[model samples]
Target: MAAAAATNVGNTWINIGIFAAFVAVTLIIVFSVSRQNKTAADFYAGGRNFTGAQNGTAIAGDYLSAASFLGIAGAIAVNGYDGFLYSIGFLVAWLVALLLVAELLRNTGKFTMADVLSFRLKQRPIRMAAALSTLAVVFFYLLAQMAGAGGLVALLLGITDKAGQGLVIAVVGGLMILYVLVGGMKGTTWVQIIKAALLILGAGVMTFWVLANFGFNLSAVMQEAVNMAGENGEAILEPGLQYGASAVSQLDFLSLALALVLGTAGLPHVLMRFYTVPSAKEARRSVVVAIWLIGIFYLFTLVLGYGAAALVGPETILAAPGGQNSAAPLLAFELGGEILLGIIAAVAFATILAVVAGLTITAATSFAHDIYASIIKKGQVAPDGEVRVARWTVVVIGIIAIIGGIFANGQNIAFLVALAFCVAAAANLPTIIYSLFWKRFNTSGALWSIYGGLISTIVLIIFSPVVSGKPADPVTGLSKSMVTDPSIDFHWFPLDNPGIVTIPLAFLLGIVGTFLSKERSHPEKYAEMEVRSLTGAGAEKAVAH
Candidate 1:
């Protein structure tokens, strides 16, 4: 079924052509920007030259992953209101980032989130913990993007076999490494800005076309979708088609909600973006701009999802090469045939490449700046050496992402990203909140919060239903868990996501560790951080240092 669906979606050569052109154009932009890479600042934070509007657009590009284009639309097409919940969770997350961390993080941190975290605390231990947590979050996120890339290109090119998809993922990983190694942050930022514009433009046109077909009536479009969904069409229109099955499922939804709402502020890649702008004011403005762009794109998803359901049907989407992840591309095929599918497929590929580049740079920057320079070399490493190490780290991280993506192919990209968010919120958010807000937050607290949350979240995920124990889909006879074997039933966690339990535990551990510690936080350092974060008085000097 998937092979047949793939063959009918688009001209394989056309899709490849569009993809090749996008890569060629973006590579030129990357090399053009590479001339700016003379210092660590340029490689890590784009030399702090981007305006708020530009950074905001780039933020939209980084934030809108394959999950936004492929996963949420598919979820909405198949599950109705419940699937739209992903959009709400993602958009609302920006509010948390804007209100809680954006300006302050920009003012306080020079390169990575660890710079802010270890400011008032004992530097070596705190930096180590923060770097570990950042790598974990980036690992999960890179896995999602790589998986999306593999499935997307495979569907468009009519590649049904695992080896073909694996090769595609490897190619994506190589491109991502090149972007980081040559273009660095400046190059990656330009790619993101370009990709974000194309994505929003593509989505906007599709939304308008879909609405025009239903006489510009949202109700008519939704009604037609329901009518065509067969007996369960009404279920799609209502809530609970996916997550309201039982008490456990309801709790799982809450976990997913908490993770999505809190995760953006803690995401290492997103938080690192705050430092790319010059001042707290620009950081704040960039958040505002990002919010509006992201909000608008999500609204377009609502229309596109229903349009796909009404026009293409859910069964066809499931039988496609990428399963739920193929809805947007399939809808493009349905609407504009070969040409539109080719265009949208290129946009989707751009989306994955841009995001993976951002994540890779963030992880590499954290390792070089925080762990290697601060902890290992004791700040004796020169800027050139640091950048060289970062470039090498990018290659290593890319290799890991390619392997992980191969194993993760064919899963719902949004669901996989939600797990990454769960890890971010659990491991990073508590420490960030405490370091910024609580004056008494010490090194012990930071270490406990980072390591405790990181370990517990990973452990619970290993034992969760997402990893194993879920029954096979009755219609498709495929296992729903990560482990596909029917006899793998080791899962002990009831919920699919561990956010509900792990988030609170992390916060509690921070507080408990603070009280139990003998080392008091440096009051003078906290005062400096407060003044700098609030007023940006020393932010520029800090960055220069």
Candidate 2:
């Protein structure tokens, strides 16, 4: 008992020290970048000058944070085949962006995603809706990050209670808001790059450890997982087990893979990163680099996940710092002892911080560039005023996210992140896709796509097993499960992803809305479209659109 207590105390100091270090580093970046904001463009879009490699690293840095490094590893640790499914999906979605959205989004829009779609329509309503949709995506995503961070801090620092969640989440929120409100994209990008490097290096080290200790044999790892789960019976992976052992397992594998692939294409935060680059060609190359980097990272994660299952045991993960999310740290500690474990914990924390930084920047930039300059300001805000509003909006949005994260502290980060993807795939993606490709897509259609998709996704989630039924249980102080039981429950949707369902609805709404609205078609618009798609011409014509 005394040894356990002493160990806990030591972990606590490490957590505190790591948290303090991240906070200090973020503040320095923010304060330093705060001084040089001479223009709104620079503040909101990183002056649109990031190199392909830098932006690519930043992209990987942004996309592969809490979800890729921790959530994926944790899911793999707990669920036999479900976690690896996430990795496959995540990588596939980049293709959608690369082949479809990348050039068009860059070729058409100057800054925000709304600029691309709303260029030919009324900018105000479009910008407002886009900002709201962006906010919704970022809000849930931010919660996931904070939740992960709080969980990491709690586990690594040995604060396992619910309040520990709140503490760490608040710390992350505070750190991220400082990055956006003070530094903008420039400061945020650097932090993301640093974190991405750390995450990749850490995963590489962990993979090496796994390989050296267990040889480079995949079959051995599988056998070990099956045996361990057999020891538990209630577990998913164990020795001698095969993939797709049951119907639920198959559904989980398919649903997770689909979410990873489609979710990446529709994610507003990721899309907005493309807008931060200067030209369409740059955007295209940026994704190529990201694909390579992200590919390597995900590959390493597979080893880490199987390693956790083979060596650490599933039950031990549940008893870890933050449920399944602690798989990476738990594995590190088991394999490399306290010092290596602490370093992994710190790298994970940095990953969370880096991701939150990008998210806050994306949402804040939309509010500044899309809503404020285009909607609220009616395109009248001066250059200086625009940057100022963006900086201010950063604080306001950050505060809201912080408060929300505080409320959602004790929950699962992966579940919340999945929820965010469902909404984005439903709401923003359909509208953006149609507006660019379909010429007949009118303003009314765009609005319906945004509004309909957003409403359906949220309502479904509120009724889903992850966060459904009652709003919140008072006596129990836990969210009432939408299903009678999360385990033996029934849901309208097959899996957590609302994309397959909601994406179709968004397209349907867009078609109906565009058909109903009798807006006069501009003949010159076709000529303009050809130019935008072909040669990236009509440069002078670019405005908020």
Candidate 3:
């Protein structure tokens, strides 16, 4: 017992040491690049100097949050083949971004999503609408990251209770704020580049180790998972374990897929990355690069997920503090012992830090560039003042995230992230699609799409099973769930996700609102918007630092 205790102590210190090293390196990068971020352009879009490959790497880093690295693996560990559906949805989503949105966004927008929406429409109302939608999506996404950060810290660092989780969250929030305020986009982009490389490397190492354990035979790994899963082994290789086998379940699956596919194009932070490149061609190249990298990374997730089931055991994973979120880290411990586990844990922490920092910068940019500089100051704020407001905005956002994280400590990270995607798809996506493609899309249509989609998503989510209740226990009149309290039993919306209903409603309202309004259509402006969006004619140029 004493020997085992000593070993545990040593492992904890090793993990702490590795985590500190990652933090130190990240801080050094931030301090070094921060000096160059003197102007709003440098702070917001990295002075438009990033190559397609660098921006692609940064995009991959931002997209693969803690939920992707740990939660997806845990879901696979717990639910079998059904968890892999998320992998498919996430990877396919990038194709949508690449084909449809990337180049157009790069050509048309400068700093925020508002810039795109306000291009041919009325500036004030459209900017306000864009700002609201951006903040809404960022809020939910940030909440998920913070909650996941707290839970992962407590689980890996052996913090036993809520107080410890809160402290961990506070520390994470502080670090994220510092990264954004000091480094801006230039600093945040480099941090993301480094984190992305480490994440891919760590996941690749684990995959190779898992494959070697099974003699490099994929079938052997699946067979082992089946065998270890016991009675549920056969089901583990098939669908229905996670979403179930019913009509409603099928609809839910479609909704989730729709949100994951369309949502990527609408994410404000992801969209903002397009502006960091010099031209529409570079944006196109970046998405292609991102597709390959993210595709390969997600493929590795399949191996890691099933490997955890086969090697770590589902029962043991379920018993861990973060449940499915603990699967990848636990697999690391099982495969390579203390040292590998420590390194993997540090990588996971870095993943959370990089992602949260990206989100904060986007949110700050929306507040400063869209709301403060454009709307309130009417584009009159000095460059330095705009950057100052952005930094202060980061502080405010970080505090809100910390408080929200404390309240949302035990929530499922994957589910919260899914909700964010649903909201993004329902609200922001229709606005973007219409603004870019539809000539008759007026300010009223844009407002309706943004406000309609945003409000409807929030309302539907409130009534959805995710918030109100899960299916009741027939015998005990209670739910056996851990994520949400079953106190309010009025969950009339059959689906947990709000995408199916809200997405269509948003599009419908945008069209109907356009027809109902007497606003004049700008045919000449549409022609100009089209030329710029397609060919990058008169698009914003990169300024030298």
Candidate 2, which ten residues in sequence have the lowest lDDT sum? 1-10
Off by over 4 Å in 3: 1-10, 471-487
How many clashes show up in model 2?
9
Q: Between candidates 1 and 2, name the one with more favorable TM-score.
A: 1
For 1-545, candidate 1 gives per-residue lDDT tens digits of: 75485557789889889989999999998998788687888899998888899999999999999878888898898888898999999999999889889998988889999999998998899999999999989988888888787778678888768898899899988998898889989899999999999999999999998999999999999998998789867888888989988999999999999999989899999999888888989999999999999999999999999988888888888778778778888889888989899999999989999999999999999999998899999999899999989988999999999998998887656656877898899899999999999998999988888888899999998898788888988876767888877587899989888999999999999999999999966999999999998999878531342
Clashes of each: 0, 9, 0
The total of clashing pairs for model 3 equals 0
Put down candidate 2 lDDT per residue, 1-545, tens digits, no spaces: 42243235236566567656766776776677557656666666677767778889989999997767877887787786667767877888889999989878777776677887777767788888888988888888988877666666677777657675676677677777777766777788878887788788889998988988767787677678667766653345432132366674455445545555666777877887776677777888999999999999998888888788778877777665566777788788778877677778778888887888888878877888887778777888788887777778778877777777777666756667887877777787788778767778888998998999899888766655565433355555555453323244434544455555676788799999999998875557745764786577753221121
How good is model 1 by TM-score?
0.97
**TM-score of every model versus the real structure:** 0.97, 0.89, 0.96
lDDT of each: 0.89, 0.74, 0.87
**TM-score of model number 3:** 0.96
